[model samples]
Target chain A: MNAPATERFVVPIGPQHPALKEPGHFEFTVEGETVVDATVRLGYAHRGIEKGAEGRNWTQTLYLIERICGICSHIHSTAYAVGVEQLAEVEVPARAQAIREIICELERVHSHLLWLGVAAHDAGFDTLFMYTWRDRETVMDILETMSGNRVHYSANVLGGVKFDLTDESAVAILKGVEFLEERTHHYRKVVSEDAFFLQRTRGVGTMTHAEALALGVVGPTARASGVARDVRLDAPYVAYADFPARIQLLTAGDLEARFLARLDELLDSFRLIRVLVAGLPAGELTAKRMPRKLKPGEVISRVEAPRGELFYYIRSTGGEQPDRVKVRTPTLCNMGSVITQTIGHNLADVPMILVGIDPCFSCNDRAVTVRRAGDDNGRAWAWADLRRYGIDYYRRIRN
Target chain B: MDTITTQSPPRWRTMLDRLRNWSLANSPWLVHYNSGSCNGCDIEILATLTPRYDLERLGVKLQGSPRHADVLVCTGPVTRQSADRLRRIYDQMPEPKFVVAVGACSISGGAFRGCYNILGGVDEVIPVDVYVPGCAPRPEAIIHGVAVLLKKLQPDRAEEIDRLLVEAGAVVGEEEGIDEPNAELLGAR
Candidate 1:
């Protein structure tokens, strides 16, 4: 296995690879079977969503923002709505807040199950993938029945929520949660005790708490490394203050801990949903009056997405449209850990390590071009200039 | 190697061609690429393969490489960075290939139409045989899109199959033992 010190071999995966469901590129410098170094390149899924948000009004921007990540669509919209509500000084009704939390927990159930299935599939365990995805349909059904859409459930409005939880839907949700709870218990057992599955996860991609903190990982990824870093607990948003979620933590920072941590959070989500539904707040669904234009101010919204903390920075210029909108999705925070942790592991474990953070390329790929003041005579570009630049850039790419 | 001829093939050659067509029609291996989707359409496409929708029941298999795929299932609006890569993937697929644009984003850019990084839709880069339009199409709609592609694959035989189904319905109206033939015909494809 001894090779020349000067010889460096690198392996590139995706933008389009079977292992990656989304589009992203990664380069791993390997020595034989072991990875010597790793680097990542993003922006493959970048669609200029932030820039698009700036031109649209607050309400329209909310819809555009929801499409940022389909898996955590509600959380994105929730963050934006909360920020807008703050800027507008509008009070969201308690009932709407509880409903938002309920949907959020249900989304967590669907998202975690989906991730479990995909992770299992990546580890050469198709049976687990089938079983977990089959179980995931229950929550999907609940979401569809409640919100009228499967993936991008437009449940959040600016002042409050779009739909109210009826008695029938509430009962259905409780019943669905009961079934999912039992199934989750079985999955928890399988993830923790199944010996064959453990070979892929048990000690793989192990990140110490210190490394996690240094890398600044967030959400369940950080919690698995024994870091108390959930936005729901640290700074409660929506109805989390009323129906607090018990943070799920695991000391082992390996892939196994990530699995167990998400599953633990799934179980906690079930409990949280049950409590919220039982003590369902009764009030108006939205505020009485919401102004078309928000006051001139800036606000930052942070919500714990399925993956991690989703941050939104919104600036209003006392117009119908926002002056600026910037989103920082959770995948961006956890992406650095993948590069640092993959070093020294088998190259085959790269996908498993990448999936450990549940990396969403679409969520994180927000590209911004920077120009120095000294360059190009420090000329300021107009909107048309930027448009022409975009066109010329692609035309050059095509040619 | 055989040279092109205006005359029809022999009986055995014709039978072999029919078998090949049937096999290809039944098993349309798919290679999915996400140009710049929000992950909604991509995940829905995955959900179709899982147990609930069970797209595999129709003999559809998702392949890893474009060379092995008969159908290209594309989601998302084409991004500036991914447009060339997407075109390259389309080029890499074997001939007689079909593309199913699965999502509003892939069809006409949907909600992300005017984004600076987006290059409209899948059709902007490659020829699309089918388009399933939705913010994110439901699993049923995606399955239908695949079925439509399957029909397109056997355009000549589709009418014949319909005629046979109608005849089978009439025969069932007359007597029993019709179900066996219908089931066999359904399973044959």
Candidate 2:
């Protein structure tokens, strides 16, 4: 794969790289064990979502935007719904808003647990991965019980929510939340106390508090670095104003700190869910008569997604369809930190550092042709030469 | 060992079909690729592998390489950039390989249709064996779609399917000696 043992070489990790579940290519140039430079090629998952929204009407676009991420579908829809609701000047019923908040918190629990499982698996801790994913069923079940769909719950409509929390559903949710709270504590202890797990995470991929702010990282990644800028706490939209969210802060600023921050939030969600269910308001599930066409205006809607802050830039041209809808997902914003963090790291740690941002390449990819890497600086070989090289290498290894 | 009964007829040849069907149905190694989905169907596919749905118990292993996989499980609509890649992956899989297109978007470009960059569903790029329909289908729907594909793989079961399709005028073939798979049998244009 390389020439001289002493010479620096470029290793291209794919649009189909084995390490990545989603399609994203990364080029890493290494000088022996240390990585000297890195560049990422996206757009493998770009389905022209923002462009598609322009053709869809306001009501239909609600379902379209929600599919941006299966893991964070609720937050995306909530962001879009609230923005559209505001543009229409329709005030949502209090009960409907509370239902939306509870679902959002449940989504947080699901997303964090999902991220934890994948992160642990990336670190070669399959045991933790299996355990966390197994426990995630509790939340998935609760969500299914509530909304009749697991992944894209479609809980948020234009003006309000789709369903209410019945007494029976509330009781079931309380039990599920209680079970998850205990399991989350166990996972937190495992990540912190397990010596081998600690070895991989404790000081690995440490980002300075200032660097995190400079890079404009958000959500648990930012909170882990001691920056508390949660959209729910800061703006308190919808039910958040009635039920304020407590910011989960950590200052370790390492991979472990990121883990701890999300875990703390998972526990906080449990508390929030209980509060939401116990004090369930009485009103209609959806607001009456939301206007089909929004008033001519442009507004920015922000929501604290499970991953981070989801920003929706919506422009209504006094028509049924939006003039333009721009979605700036947190993964796209946090990608800067991931690329920058890859430098000065060991080649083995590249995957670990890159996934620390918990990237959803599908959410971030907007079609752009990545420049072919320029550092292949070796002699070009013909097809015959490459075949010969493969034959000789395998032959030598066999001998 | 159980004794073979000679009274009814020779029954050993039937085990050949049964054994093959059992092995094929039991262990379907899946190679998942997101052509251009929102990650909604992708995560649900992964969830199918997790304990809640446990697609593994049915012998579904998520493989990393297309060369090693028995089925190519794809999610989302096919974007222009990914259409070529999707075709290449489909070509790379071994013979008898199946393609399971999950999500409503992948089936007929449900949401992402008419987007300039999107080529629409997986079928636009490659032949799909099964279509699991949902904005993003649940894990149960995914498993059921796979089961439908696996069921058709059996030689005896395939004849039954072909007969049904022939009766419905979906596939233009007779039940006897019709080995070739017609395009219409793929379902849902």
TM-score of each: 0.89, 0.85
Q: For residue B55, give model 1's deviation from the true position in Å.
A: 0.6
lDDT, residue A77, model 2? 91
The CAPRI quality class of candidate 1 comes to medium
**What is the TM-score (0 to 1) of chain A in model 1?**
0.92
The whole-model lDDT of each prediction reads 0.88, 0.81
Q: What tens digits encode model 1's per-residue C-alpha lDDT throughout A66-156?
A: 9998999999999999999999999999999999999999999999999999999899889999999999999999999899999999999
Per-residue CA lDDT of model 2 for B32-70, tens digit only, reads: 888888888888887878776677765679978888888
Calculate each model's fnat, 2 decimals. 0.88, 0.74
TM-scores of chain B alone in all candidate structures, in the order given: 0.74, 0.72
Stretches of candidate 2 off by over 4 Å are A1-6, A367-399, B1-26, B155-189
| Worst lDDT 10-window in candidate 2 chain B | B1-10
Tens-digit lDDT track of model 2 for A273-386: 999888878998888899988789999999998879889889998999998888888998788898788788888887877778888887788632234688555664564774
- Runs of candidate 1 with Cα error greater than 4 angstroms are A1-7, A368-399, B1-20, B155-189
lDDT value for model 2: 0.81
